[model samples]
Each structure stands twice: as structure tokens, then as C-alpha cells.
Target chain A: MTQARLMDGTALARRIVEETAKRAADITERTGTAPCLATVLVGEDPASVTYVRMKRNRCRTAGITSRHVPLPADTTTEQLVGTLRELSADPGVHGILLQHPMGPHIDERAAFEAIAPEKDVDGVTFASFATMSFGLPGFVSCTPGGIMRLLDEYGVDPAGRRAVVVGRSAILGKPAGMLLLARDATVTYCHSRTTDLSAAVREADIVVAAVGRPRLIRGQDVKPGAVVIDAGYSPGNVGDVDFDSAVKRASLITPVPGGVGPMTIATLLEQTVDAAARQLGV
Target chain B: MTQARLMDGTALARRIVEETAKRAADITERTGTAPCLATVLVGEDPASVTYVRMKRNRCRTAGITSRHVPLPADTTTEQLVGTLRELSADPGVHGILLQHPMGPHIDERAAFEAIAPEKDVDGVTFASFATMSFGLPGFVSCTPGGIMRLLDEYGVDPAGRRAVVVGRSAILGKPAGMLLLARDATVTYCHSRTTDLSAAVREADIVVAAVGRPRLIRGQDVKPGAVVIDAGYSPGNVGDVDFDSAVKRASLITPVPGGVGPMTIATLLEQTVDAAARQLGV
Candidate 1:
């Protein structure tokens, strides 16, 4: 059996970043201001810290400035909201990224709402989700946005396809399914509560595994010649899909480390520039 | 074969309205002010005018006060938005309903957004959509909310069920699917672009027909013993489902005119009172 062709998100994300860099440069030269992304991190969660650092590095590489706001672990929700409001009012900041899972004490939704819609580049706000759901012009959640780009790059049209999304998290699976639905795909959302996961997977022409369970989707469950996208990244560099087995059955597949991971930050950078351009009226 | 049982949305809606009326009376007695719903109608479209009148009549029946703000057909987006904002800010107004299909030139979204989230009882704003999608504490689109209540009334547990929603409209199809997904049902959204609509419908344990097409879903398309909620209304009182055929196949089915229509207004009145109670601190 022919092995499934790899959907190289690394290569695609690189091209996207390069294009975004050029736009960032053009905006900077024209408006005398480089695009800026404000990264707000509350508390010292190791995973979140690493994610923020990586994003800041990407911003630097893409000719965008990064402003890091490191809040104390015991910072109150009101204080955090106040800080976000300041950044929202700051004309210098084109985009705002709030590193989440903020110690479980903070009102995450309230914090997200504090960011202005125009600068909500991370797309965590309610406004962004609504726009994504309605297929209107607005920023998108990064991981889902990247997934769409990957599909576009691979010439996989979602129109009229039966796309099964095996997750329903706000920022990831939910938005991903909505984006697919917007593209005219018949989209099904299945999560942990789903009674028959395998039955749903078998019917999918496109399967997006995002439930964060390593190897939850196996080769036998995958329909022949299906397009498989594994957006879930567990510890130890494993994805939600049983990649080794799935690749044999899938027509196209995204690998764990190099697939969705790279596209996320790439999308963040691209949206930052897009926000900056719009903000600067360039 | 035994015929399908009627969902009886009209009876349910009457009960709901009675309960809402009691709440409205209590709030009015305690606060010395009835719950006020401000109905903003843009343009003189005959259909829109009729809808606004129906809503106002429902408000009166539920002991809620209705304030109608009629705008001329040539009203600009700015003027309409300003009127909505004023109503949103008014302490006397507990809910705002902006009757839509406001001319081709009007920015409908902007108008909807003008109503503050607290007063968005119609659930037309982006904030309400996000909350509904995320299963958070917020008002839902009236039609979708009524559909959910119908399911609950009939003891149809959505959890572990397969729900297929045949529409993608912002207020109806999209929110209905999201609501079902939030309830832990594996939800599929099938629209006009769906290649095999019947196939998708056949797999559904609960089907929501909201595409506003006449008899689009035939009896054969519905799975035997499925719970079918026909939320669509076309010309001549026809629905998206062929009532005669679907009633034979469905285990429980809602009829045209008597089903979702009355429930929509019932939900509106309920949410209006809820909003009023919250704002009045009752």
C-alpha cells in the first residue's frame, strides 16, 4: 500500500512567515512603526511560559516587536483586566496575546474580553469566535487558522466533504469545525461525551483529531484515503493519532511535531501583521 | 406502524409564557416597574413590521412592557446604531430586540452589536453567540433556545446522541448545532452545500430542520424513531420536513405553525424577564 503523503506544515508555515515578514517590513517602512504584539503571562506555568517565549521569538524573526507583561502569581482578575485595558488603548500595540490557563483562579473569560476586538490577534475573545462561526471577516484562533491554511496549501477543498472533528475545546476543535463548516463542509463535532467515536470517524472524508489523547485514533478506525489532521500534542512528542498506522490508511496526514505545532505560531505572526496593517491603515 | 407523537411546542410555550408572566408580575410588584423590551425596527418591510407587532403582542400578554422604536426605510446604519445604543443604556429597558432584514445597505451586524450584552435578549449579538457556543451563562438565540427547551420537555437527552442540524444561519442553524454539541451530542451541520444531505440525516438520532425550505426532508431521509424538530416555516405554512411522511417515521415530531413559532416568542419573553430581574437586582 502506498504511504500517505505528508502535509508539510513546517514548509508551509515557513512560507507564510516569510510572506508575513515582508508585509511587516513594508508596514514598518511606510508607517515608521513595526508591528507590535503584547504577550501577557499570568503566573509561571512552565508550559505557558515556554509557549510565550517561543511566540516572542517568532515575533522578533518576523520583524514584529513583542512586549511581555509578566504578572505575579497572586495577581487579581481586576488587576489583570486593568492591565489588558491599558494595552487595548495603546495605539502602539497592534495585537494582544494572553497566555492562558492562568492558575484556575483568574476569570479567564473576563480577561479575554478586556482585549479590544481589533487587537485580539490571539482570537480568544467572544467576538473572534462569533465571527469565525458566522464566516465573517475577523481574526481566528491560531491553531484552527493554521489548520485551514494547511488544508488550502495541500489543495484539499473542504466543500461538500464530511469532516469529523474529534474534540470541542473553545480555541481548537470548536473553531476548527466552524471554519470547516464555513467552507461548506458537512462538519460533525465529537468529543469525550461521544458514544461511538469510531462510527463517526469511519464516515469522515476529513478527520481532525484534537482530543489530546495520544494514539486515540488508530489505523483500523480511519477510513481509506481520508485526510487526517492530528492537532493534539501530548507529552513526549506524541499526537492524538496513531501516526504510524494512520499514515498507511490516510491519503494525506499531518505528523506530530512538524505538522500543527509550527503552523500555530506562524499563524499568530501572520495575524499580528494583518492586525498591524489594518490598525495602521496601510 | 404507530404514528409519531406530537412534540406540542404550542402547549409547552403556553406553559412557559404563563411561568414568565408570573415572574414578570413578581418583578413588577417588587421593583414597581415591569420588564421593558425595546423593539427597534429598521425600514418598513411588511414582514419585519408584522414580526415586530407579534413580538410586542407577546410581550403584552406576558405582562412585560413593550417600547417600539420605529425607523424610516432610509435610516442610515449610524442612526440605527445610535438608537439601539440609547436603548441599551436606558435603565428602563431590560431587553432590546432589533428586527432584522434591514435593507441591503444597512450594516446589520453593527446594529446588533450596539445592544449591550446584558440587554441582548434577542441573542443576536456576537457575545451571545459565543456564550451559547461555549455553553456559558448567557442568553441564547430565541428560536434555538426554544428548540432546546422542546427537547428537554420531551425528555430527549442529547448526550451520546447524534444530532444533525440542516441549516447554518447565524441565529438558527449554527447556534442550534452548537447548543446540541454543548449538550454532548455528536453534532453534524449539513447545509445546502452538503453533498449527501439524506445520508447525514439518516444517521441522526435527533434532527433539526431549519433551512426554511418547503418539504426538503422526506420521510425516507429521516431515521426511523428519530426525534425530528421542524423549525422551518415556508410559504403556505409548509415546513422543511414533509409532515405527513416524516410524522410516520419520526418517534416524536413538531408540527408546522404550532411548534417552533410560539416557542420563539415564549423564549423571548422569558429571557426579557430574566434580563430585567438581573438588572433590577431582583
Candidate 2:
């Protein structure tokens, strides 16, 4: 069988960031104030630091200002929440991002709730999730939003399709299913609790592998002509899906490093400018 | 073929209401304040009036007081929002219920957002929707909450199950899917935009019919031994699933008038009491 056409998220993301830069420039000129994103990170986890720095670097290229708040590993939930609350009330901050997995004791959800919906550019708030679930106009969680954009870019219409989302993390799998559901796709969620994962994957017209296990989805299990999205990434740039095996079965597939990872930062920048425009009334 | 066991929602609701009434009475006696629910009705539609009256009547029977706010058919969105804002600020009103289907001119979502999350017992606010999506501690939309309770009452464990939800309305299908996802069930949302509804239904281990269509699901499309929940309702008390056909193929099913309907009211009363207890600190 012929190999599936690759969904080039990296190329799409680059184009998106370029467009966002122009919009940011226009907004700054019109309002005399540039878009600003405040990122708070607790502890110096290497991965977290790298992700935050990457985002800030992208913001600089996009003509947006970035504020970084690094807290100690022993920071309490109250301190974190207070810091986020201040950011929420700050008129200069158009967007806020609190890096995930903040130590074991700190209440992560509480910190997310502290960010005002208007400034929730990362779309991690309860309001944004609900709006996405209802298919109303609102900022979506970055990865899921980027995935939807990628699908639209590739002309993969979700309307009436059987789309199976493998995994159910709050920011990824769950919201992804809701977004698909809103677009009129029949969405199924599979996770660790799923009894027959392979059987469920075989029936999908569109398969989203986001369980974070490298090569979890093999080629033989994928339906012929299905759209396979490997949203999972392990250390060393390995994706959840078996790329070699899946490519033979799928009609379309996303490759590691060049797939969902890059799209996330692209969506974050796009939404930041959108938020800034709204806040500035430009 | 053996007939499915009919799940009795009326009996379950009566039991639930009794417990709610007792808790409400105790709280009122201790705090010297009765539980109060603010019912905001827009326009003079007969069905809206009837539903509001039914809720108020039930509140009275459960020892909860009702505060009514009736608006004109020509009421503008700002005026409606202002009224809701005033009610939201009132300390006496422990819970707020905005009857659905406000006039087309009014922005219903804006009005719903006006009600503070603390008083949004009906779970229409954006915050409540997000909390439900995240599986956080917050109230849920009544019909969806009731349907979940019915499933639990019938011993239908969602974990490791494949749940296919038919419909995508904000208050019903969408939230129902989220609740199921929270419990680790594989969920699929099907709606009018879906191409092959029968095939989707046949793959479900559990089916939630919330499209309000009469007899939309037939037995031929049902998987044997699946748990079927019919949340649909028509003018003549008709359910979405064809009872005669579905009963023969399912392991359990909920009846129309006595099923999801009663649970909605039960959940309403329960949330009202919980709100009152929190506000009064009893």
C-alpha cells in the first residue's frame, strides 16, 4: 500500500505565527500598547523551563511582550493563586499561562481558575472549556485548537465522521472530543479504563492517539483510509503511534516533532493577539 | 426476547426529595432562614410558565421558598441581564434558575452568565459548565445530572464502557458526554449532522438519547445487553428510543414521564438545598 500523505503541522504553524505577527503589529500601532503574555512557572523542571522559554521566544518574534514569573518549588497553592489573581486583574496582561505539574501539593486547578476568562489565552479556564464544548465562540485549549486548525487546513471535514480520541487528559483528549463533537463528528474516548482499546481504534474513520505511550497504536489496528493523528510524544521525539506501520494503513498521518508539538505554540500566539485586540478594543 | 427491566425514576426522585426536604428543614431551623431559589422567567410563553410553576410548587413542597422575577417579551438583553445581576447579588437567593427558551432577541447566554456560579443551581453558567467538564466539584445541568443518577441507580458503571450519546444540545448531550468522559467511559456524541446514526448506536455499550425526537432509536440499532437511557421528550410524553422495540433488546431502560423528567426536578431540589446549606453555613 502507498504511504499516507503527511499532515505537516510544523509548516502550518510557521505560517500561523507569521500571520499573528502582522496582526500584533497592527494592534500595537492602533492602540499604542503591545500584546502581553504573563507566564508563571513553579520549580525549575527542565522540560517546563524549556517549554516556557520556547513560548516566550515565539512571543518576541510575534511582536508581543512576555513576562516570566518563576516561583520556588515549595510555593504554596495560596501564593500561586494570589500571584495568578494579580495577573488576572492586571490590565496590561492580555494573556496568562501557568505551566502545568506545579509540585504535588499545590492545587493546579485552583491556579488555573484564578486566571480570568478574558485573559485565559491558553484556554485552560472552565468558561473556555464550556464554550468549546458548546461550539460557541471562545479560545480553545492550544493543542486541541491547533489540531482542529490542522484538520481544516487539510480539508478533513469532521461532520458525520466517527472520530475516536484515545486518552482523556483534561486539556487534551477530553477537550479534543468536545471540539469534535461540536463539529458534528461522532466522538469516542478511549483511555486506560478502556477494556477493548484495539477494537475501538479499528472502527474509527479518524483516530487521535494522545495517551503519551510511544508506539501504542500499531499499523494493523488502524482502519484503511483513516486519518491518524499522533498527538503523543515520548522522550527522544517518539510519538504514541507506530509511524511506520500506521503510515501504510492511514490515508493521512502526523509525524513526530513536526506534528502537534509545534501547533500548540502557534495557537497560543494566535489567541494572545486575539485577546489583546479584544482587550484594547482595536 | 425478554423485556428490559424498567428503571423507576419516580420512586428514586421521591426518595431523593424526601432526603432533600429533611436536610432543608434542619438547615432552616438551625439558621432561621429558609432555602430560597430565584426563578427568572423571560416572556409569557405558556410552557415556560408551566415549567416554572411546577418547579416553584416542588420547591414549596420541599420547604424551599421561591422568589419570582418575570420579564416582558420585549425585554432587551441588557435589561434582562441587569435583572439577573440584581438577583445574583441578593444574599437571600441561594440558587438561581433561568428558564430556557427566552425570546429570540434576548442573548440568553449573557443572562445565564449574570447569575453568579454560587447561585447557578441549574448549572447554566460558563463556570459551572467548565467545572462539569473538568470533573471538579460544582453543580451540573439538571437533566444530565438526573440521567447520570439513573444510570448509577440501575448499576450501569460507566468505566471501561463505550457510551454513545445522541444529541449535542448544551444542556443535555454535550454535558452528558463530559460527565461520562470524567468517569473514564469511552464517549461518542452524535447529532443531526451525523451521517449514519444507526451504525453509531449499534456500537454503543451504553446509549444516551437526548435529541427530543420521538422514537429515534429502534431495537435493531441497539446492542444487546446495553444500558439505554432515553432523555428525549415529545408533546405526548414520547421518548426518543422506541420502547417496544428497545425494551426487547436492552438490559435496562428508563421510562419517559417517570424517567429523566422526575430526576431533573430531584436534582434541582438537591442542589437548592446544598446551596442553602453553604450560604447559611448550617
Top of the candidates by DockQ: 1
Question: In model 1, what is the error at residue A170, expressed in angstroms?
Answer: 0.5
lDDT of each: 0.95, 0.91
Question: By lDDT, who's the top model here?
Answer: 1
Compared with the true structure, the alpha-carbon lDDT of candidate 2 equals 0.91
Model 2 per-residue lDDT tens digits across residues B163-260: 99999888888889888888878888888988899998998999999998999999999999888999999989999999999999999998888988
The sequence of per-residue lDDT tens digits that candidate 2 reaches over residues A1-282 is 699999999999999999999999999999999999999999999999999999999999999999999999999999999999999999999999999977899988888889998898898888888888878898899999999999999999998898999988878988898888888788888999888889999989999999899999999889999999999999999999999999999999999989888999999999999999999998
lDDT of 1 by residue, A1-282 (tens): 889999999999999999999999999999999999999999898999999999999899999999999999999999999999999999999999999888778999999999999999988999999999989999999999999999999999999999999999999999999999999999999999999999999999999999899999999889999999999999999999999999999999999999988999999999999999999999
Best prediction by TM-score: 1
lDDT of 2 at B260: 84
Model 1 / residue A224 / CA error / Å: 0.8
